[model samples]
Target: MKKKLSLTSKIFIGILLGALFGIALKWLPSGTLKDSILLGGIIKIMGTGFINAIKMLVVPLVFVSLVCGASSMGDVKKLGRIGIKTMCFYLVTTAIAITLALGIGKLINPGLGLDMSSIVTTETVIAENKSLVDIILGIIPSNPIQAMASGEMLQIIAFALLVGVSISILGKKAEPVKILFESLNEVCMKMVGIIMLVAPYGVFALIANTFATVGFDAIWSLIKYMFAVLLALGIQGFIVYSGMVKSLSGLKLKPFLKKFANVAGVTFSTSSSSAALPLTIESMEELGVHNSVASFTLPLGATINMDGTAIMQGVACIFIAQIYGIDLGITQFLTIILTATLASVGTAGVPGVGMITLSMVLTSVGLPLEGIGLIMGVDRLLDMTRTTVNVMGDCACTLVVSKSEGELDLDMYYSKEENNIAKNA
Candidate 1:
């Protein structure tokens, strides 16, 4: 009879072992660890494959869940209102994050007095030169089958919203279809659970591959800029998120932090809210948040909500500007905030998207795109941190919305300590 450890404990062990394993490969003797088996490849392919599998589920899960949530509203206008409120919350918070990041970053001047003479320009990332027409038109796909095949999230979102609205209009006639969708949702959720079972192996490989290929010595050159990005993330995750959670709901900070530790660890290692969705949802449910709120807000948060990533863009812009000895005016600062927020909406929650969106943000405000190469190598680790904040923000938003809608189970929330008692009884 082995002891049953908590999810938190298990993940903590995985992270510890992953880090030590990674360090050993980097610092110690290579032997077989670096030879025949190729530890890094296993980590790279498995970790990335795990992420892709989860993302493959994202479109279907989100589409069905949104349709279910919206159909229940029974009022298109009310549905519109909720949509507005949710998007506005995400967009506003994102803009504020960028603003704070730029302000703090510039004040600190993280890139000042830098010598860029040795900076070798790597492969440059370019943003899709999307016109307003292209962006709007791209929202509704002509072929949803192709959209799903291609994993186009925006098209999937649009298609699902339409289906959900249509189902709501069908009234009693839609009951059978609704029942089928709900069942489909349940089956899909079970699949999410199965995917997470191998998470330890996947996560280990991903981290190991990342650290092995791009060792810390590679990032030693840009340590100041990296810390600047981290400082901004810390401020946003702790100060901003804490304030928002407290102000929006009467819940205290202590429990939120305690519950989020596991979720944060998963996000940091996985570098993806989409990948961490299952754990995040479970954590919120365990904390007594309603399924309706979690399902509605968390998926949306994974897509268009990227406060930490936006902060990275802000700091990067400043650093690049200083590195090139260019001064930014007040108008330009506002422009960066607006552009970063917009870029995040289109930024895919995947590895390459950050650099692409950062390129977009830089171009919008006339910043040099060349500076992107400087940070390309280290973006993976920073992505890990940013994704953790993304998941954290999602959970907090769910709590706030739940509390406001009177959907939260306060008794269950405060009874977190009663898990053992309930289990025993």
Candidate 2:
């Protein structure tokens, strides 16, 4: 019998091939065929379609799965406990991530000896700085339907929790509603499986489009800054997350990473944690995280858990300060950590949102916003790397929470058998 490639292997191959294809397009002379037909036309359409397909599932999956998960939890107290734990884990990890980034940034000195005058200043749009009180208040949706339509994730999460709690409180009377949500949740998972069938091709197109437009040249100028961000992301993803899974959950790291490889690939290619939510939730369930846990934590994580963005802000802060020849004292360093950690909660899980939040971090510590423009050229590539880290953080937190709550299936989690969710679907 011939062996077949697994989805993980296929996605990896797609990434490699896509990089090569993109480089080939980059080297070719600019023309209608190279720039217009292939790069802008086919690649653009395919990549956008793939992203849209993935995004199509996020809102429905989050709302339905979360509702089902909440309703299934008979004890509202337990739900509150889980919520508190998840939030604490997210905030602490984010703080740790930025701290790590700051340490690494100082050691690497990514912006030292830079010729600031030669760098092109890209325009940056700073996000409005929302106070903590405002952010907390914004979570409660006055009109949930409007919140859902606008895709205000925190508001949607708030509304979903309320609806789910009502269903649980009603018990027998609300059985039909709970059953409907469960069915919808299953349908959403099936949709995830269906969409994943095209993920390899989608990964290819997305990666190709990125490299085709922003080639290797972009990294040459800010190579040290880029290296700093990449290094921090790598440590956070591999070492920090791995340690958390091992120490907290006692789960085997290899199996967890193997199972998550496909989702990581999708996250890397798309550079949006929100777009990868469906797969992230499905993968967690396959890894033996009960849906009640996966559904709740992953959606909430998608909305607020932003360790990766914090890492970037940390590194970028140090890099920008160095470029402008400013010395940050202990107070500034502490301020960066505090600001970035809280800012993660308000930050949306999308491409380039990090830069907007980065501005806020820079402002908090007195770094020039112009420094953002210097790194803008390479942010796209860095965004892809950091997004993978963000998703990994979500999974690690989910695993820890599930294990702590006794919601993890140990036998299933440690099972050596291949995960056939995508294949079987």
Candidate 3:
């Protein structure tokens, strides 16, 4: 009898084959065969359908799972601590990512000889630079129905917390509601499992389509900028995340990376952490994090933790400044970090959203928005890599919280057999 392949192995195989298939398509003649029939028709359908399937689960999963996580927290103080720690870890990592990116960009001088004379500035409406007051007020959700209809995550998070806390406080009176949410959370997690059975094909289609269309030419044009962003991502993922996992959870780094690779593949192909959340939760559980921590931290991380995006913003800001010959003063550099860190909160979990938030960062540093035009061509590919890093940050945060809360199972984390048993059970 043949052994069943693990999901991680399947996902990696899918990514390898998909990349090769895309490259083959890129080599095809420049006419209808490659552009119209292959990329536009078949590839588009498969990729878009898969993303839609994942997206359909995001809001429901976040709401139901978060509600369950919150209500299950018997102690309000512990919940508060979890919230504070989670937010602090996410923000601190993002700041570190930006700082690292800036340092690398300066050393590399990615934009030293770049010419922006021909880059035209369009008067696009930039993302609103919300003040602290505005951001606080906005979280209240004047109309929660509208918030849900629009998929407003921060508002949804706020509303869910309210419901969960109320249920926790009410005790017996809220038992029915709490039980219903727990059932709903279980249903959503089961949905994630079912959806993931087809995940290999979905990841294949998404990646193949992306590579077939975008090709490598765009990347060559801005290689330095890409390298800068990727360097920061590499340092954060390998050095920072590995260190944290070992120190905080006291688990061997190898097993964590092995489990996280599956989640990384999903995030890389989809380029949307929100879409990747269901699988992230599953991957975290497979790595032995308790469901309460996985459910809460993963959702919260998807919404606000954006170390990857911040790294790109930081690198891009520096590159643009060098191109325009604008020397960033100390205060300007600090503002860039602060603005990018805060702006990530309002950023949506979707493809190419880094561009939107980049606009905010640039404006904060008095850089030209047209500089974005230079990076747009290669942004798609960078977005994929950075998003993988973003989700890694989420997983790392989940592990940290699980350790602190005594919710992590080291035996499960270290033992492959134990993980399989838990999955089978």
Candidate 1 residues lying further than 4 Å off, grouped into runs, are 1-81, 117-221, 417-425
How many clashes in each structure? 1, 0, 0
What is the Cα root-mean-square deviation between model 2 and the actual structure? 11.4
Residue 227 error, candidate 2, Å: 0.7
Off by over 4 Å in 3: 1-78, 117-221, 417-425
lDDT of 3 by residue, 209-231 (tens): 54565555323436988888888
- Local lDDT at 407 for model 2: 97
lDDT of 1 by residue, 1-425 (tens): 99997543554455556656766777756766584366535654665565555545655665665576555546325456555666777878898889888877877877765644232122223234455566668667899999877555556656866887788788799989888887886766666667656555655654454345445532343677788888888988898889988998988887789989989888877777898898888888888888877777788788768898898989988887776566776656665776677556544554444654565556545565545545553565587888888778778778887887777888878786566668889
**146 in model 1: Cα distance from truth in Å?**
28
Give the Å error, residue 416, model 3: 1.4
**Candidate 3 local Cα displacement, residue 194, angstroms:** 32
Query: What is candidate 3's local distance difference test score?
Result: 0.73
TM-scores, one per candidate? 0.59, 0.59, 0.59
TM-score of the candidate numbered 3?
0.59
